[model samples]
Target: MSEQKKKIERLTGVKGMNDILPADAPLWEFFEATVRSLLKSYGYQNIRTPIVEHTQLFTRGIGEVTDIVEKEMYSFTDALNGEKLTLRPENTAAVVRASIEHNLLYDGPKRLWYVGPMFRHERPQRGRYRQFHQVGVEALGFAGPDADAEIIMMCQRLWDDLGLTGIRLEINSLGQADERAAHRRELIAYLEQHADRLDEDGKRRLHTNPLRVLDTKNPAMQELVDNAPRLLDFLGEASLAHFEGLQRLLRENNIPHKINPRLVRGLDYYNLTVFEWVTDQLGSQGTVAGGGRYDPLVEQLGGKPAPSCGWAMGVERILELLKDAQRVPEPDGCDIYVVHQGEPARIRAFIAAERLRDAGLDVILHCSADGGPASFKSQMKRADASGAAYAVIIGDDEVAADNATVKPLRGAQAGDADAAGASQQQSVAFDALAEHLIERMTA
Candidate 1:
């Protein structure tokens, strides 16, 4: 291939991943800021773990037989020490492993939040990517239904803060490990009867985790799942009470939810209170966020059996929902654009722009050297495109008179624009352009 072609190919992002360009930065800022503020209000602290961990950590914490560990992990050996490592497919397991390694569990209950990229080797789809971003929260050491309720409430609060609409919460309890195991046996027996009709993947799931049959996308398998044993029927007394208590809390808080008995999560670690936030805006991949209780996960990863619960939401999926709902806000733009004419005027414009920026206003200083008087119109157009609320024009005439011309780019009616002509420009005494711009922008 030619060098030009090679350069073009190198510029492209890897498949199933994207570069979040300047245009998308504002949306990201809004989403992350809203989530961070909400998490802080709920008394959760931020915790960041490594992007890669020992491969065994996930194998033990997320389950070796599960899709994330068995099929989707991006694992490789470290070049330095030859230790096998894998990019995290999810945060809960890595966070659990961090807690164990650092002995955070001994310090009592901890509420933590994390936001970053997760890698999984999977076919790219509309809402699915090989690499994705997730904002998640983990509440560890609390084992009762109250902790579960708090996590659910936090999610609701996050959605409200983001001004998200038309989302439904579907929740279910998978009961304790033993109860799930008993239910799994009965589910396998049902699958055995329909073995001939089962797809290869479904049959494989039957031998490993028969409960996953209910999570199948196949309509034929779904028919079988509908009549299969419901986990709710097999919940022990304690598990039943825990599920009821969670429902009561939701009622008291006025959080609308539906009890979905077939909502067992795809992960093997989840033992109770698996839930998902779903919307109809996205076609088949409607689940924006979901997680549940994984009480034994920490212990399984060499921790002292610390109970933990958490949830993760896909950033891309949420962005899609926001776009479909027309909820994304317009980007914030420069507050002031400084347009200068002559070389001397350019220096003055730079100084004035600095003053405006120091006063907490965003100022864009134009320093092009090629244009003469004709550049004024082009500079004004650039200022307009910058979405600047105001423009400060400094030309040879203004600089000679030791004055500056400030005009409102927006928030001016037709009459106001006419009244505020060249003569109407604000006259700042000395180098007080910053104060003048601050007052005008705020107004």
Candidate 2:
């Protein structure tokens, strides 16, 4: 290859991964900020865990038979200790493990939220990356249907805040262990009758988790899956009551939802109340967020038996939905731009800029001294391009006079003649420019 092509190859990110450029930062910031604020209002504290954990955590917690543990985990051996570690495919197991390890449950029921990267070895596609981000909430040590209701409401609130419409909430109950065991027996027998027709993956699932056959999206498998026994039919009395209580709570809160019996989530730890938030806009991989009540996950992760229910939304998928609906907000603009014309004015601009920043205003300072008076026009243009609401013009005249011109950086004519006219310009005290910008921006 030519040297230019070789250089270009070295500049690319790995396949299935992407670098979030500056233009995309605002969307991420808005989503995270809105989630944090919403979760805070609902009394959820922030929690963070290591990015990599023992590979066995997922193997046991997410289940060895699941695609995540079996195929998608980025597992590697630690060079120093020869211990095995894997970048987390999801955060639920790690969060539960942290709660147990730290005894975070001692202070009663705990509510926590996390936002970070998650890795999975998958084909890169639109809204699906091997390295993606997730914003999730975990409510540990809570068992009642009310906890489930709270989380569903919180998820709805987040979607609404993002201006996402046409979202469908699908929920299901996987029931307790004993209930699942009975259903598993019946499901296995039913699949066995059609064993010869099963695909390779379906056959493997039949031997491991027969319930997963219902999760298949293959059109050929749909007929067989449609005839399979539904979990709702097999749920015991207690499981039935739990499902009813959740539905009742959702009804009381006026949250519209439909009960989907086939959403047995791609994990073994999930028990009861498996739900997903899907949007029709995104074609095949439409699931934006999905999780369920994992009462056994904490215990499986070496923590004391603590019932927990939570959900994790893929940031990539959510962003796709926003983009499809044209709902993503415009990038934020700077509040004020400080333009200087001379060396003394540049120095004063630097000092004044710091003061404005310390006073909680977003200020951008143009400190070049070579531009002279002619540079003021270009500086003004820069200020306009920065999306600043106001521009502070500082020159030798203003610095010597201990005054500044606070011009509303809008309604500018083509030439400086209109801008230079005293009748068109507004002069404010040099020290009060920050307050003036704040008042104007706020107004």
Best candidate, lDDT: 2
lDDT of 2 by residue, 1-443 (tens): 55564444556679988999888988888888888889999999999999999998888888888888888999999999999999999998899989988999988889999999999998999889999999999999999888988899888988888888988899999999988998999999999999987888899899798888899888888888888888899888888898899999999988999988888899888898889988778888889988879999888888778899999999989988877888777888887788888778878888888988988988888744564454787888888888876788889899988878877765442123454464345677877777776776677
> Residue 435 error for model 1, in Å?
1.6
By TM-score, the best candidate is 1
Which 10 consecutive residues of model 2 have the lowest summed lDDT?
411-420
Please report the TM-score between candidate 1 and the true structure: 0.92
Q: Report the lDDT of model 2 for residue 419.
A: 42
TM-score of each: 0.92, 0.91
For model 2, the superposed segments whose C-alpha errors exceed 4 Å read 1-10, 367-374, 411-423, 435-443
Candidate 2 achieves a global lDDT of: 0.86
Q: Compared with the true structure, what per-residue lDDT tens digits does model 1 show for residues 1-443? A: 55565444446679987788999888889899998888899999999999988898888877878988889999999999999999989889888878888888776999999999999997888778989999999999988988999988888887788788888999999999899889988888888998997998888989897787788878766777888889899999999998999999999999999988778787888987899999887887789999889998887878787788999999998888777767777989888898888888888888888777777888898855565454888998988899988789898888888888887777643126344354345655437677776776666
